[model samples]
Target: MTDPCGACGARGCEELFHGLLALDHSRAEPWGPLHGVSVSCFLLQHPARLPADGGAAARGLLRAYLDGGLPAVDRLIGRARAANSHRVTGRSAPGGAVPPGREAPRGGFAVTVEEVAQDGTFPAAGFPDRVRAWAAATLEVWGPVSP
Candidate 1:
């Protein structure tokens, strides 16, 4: 079998993703406000799952949430939608050095999908709180944003 996921060290990463998807779908109302931050946190931890432009966007959104909470994140998403561009591209320095604020963390996150799963499934009353905690913990592990 392939090695465990580098980010979360989870052997069944795909299953975890599917479980998250199910949670999102079944708990749309509760998950709505936290969706962007949740996805951003997950993507930041699992960098390989993100596309080239996605990394920067995910980091931007996560930083926005941490710095200004949901309102700030809403503003950013609004601006992107208004511009008809949701993707945020990263810029590299002269010698191919990645610009600050553009780099994703290089190791496993402090919180993993496994930990979230321990809080129970989507139908469980505490699932939403668990997810919120997961996002917060993940962001905390990444530390402060460079920019």
Candidate 2:
């Protein structure tokens, strides 16, 4: 789907800091060389206190996420398959089947974003930090999943 924010799908930390954040992101990108899989982490933010005109919209963010976000995510996860054909067929190596929940993210998982950077006022706080940590972990193939 096309991102309303032009490319990033959502805006940047500035928007997040101002509490004007909203996004429809899918996969930030998959990592790990092992039994690799795709994971999509969607982050949606409404005004912390809600604006006068946005109370209804803000109040319904979770519902929207549940009804729209989660279903879309599930569809994404369902449609998600191992990118490498060899891996899907186990032609790459020997491995047992995954139990469950070990696959792609189910419905919606929770992410806690504290303060990271800042908008010269509030701390960017956990948002940047978490994303950075995730990016690093991805590059290093953190946890190295077994097939």
Q: Count the backbone clashes (under 3 Å) in each candidate.
A: 0, 9
lDDT of 1 by residue, 1-147 (tens): 647787767556667767777766664666557677767767767877776664667667766776677798888888777666445454321111124555656555656666666633544556556666666776666565444
lDDT of 2 by residue, 18-123 (tens): 3422211322221111001111112222223224422222223222223354354344334433434455653232112222454321211122122222332223
- The TM-scores of all predictions, comma-separated, are 0.67, 0.20
Against the unseen true structure, what C-alpha lDDT does each candidate score? Answer: 0.63, 0.28
What TM-score would you give candidate 1 relative to the actual structure?
0.67
What residue runs in model 2 are displaced by over 4 Å at the alpha carbon? 1-48, 70-111, 115-147
Clashing pairs in 1: none
Error of 2 at 93 (Å): 54
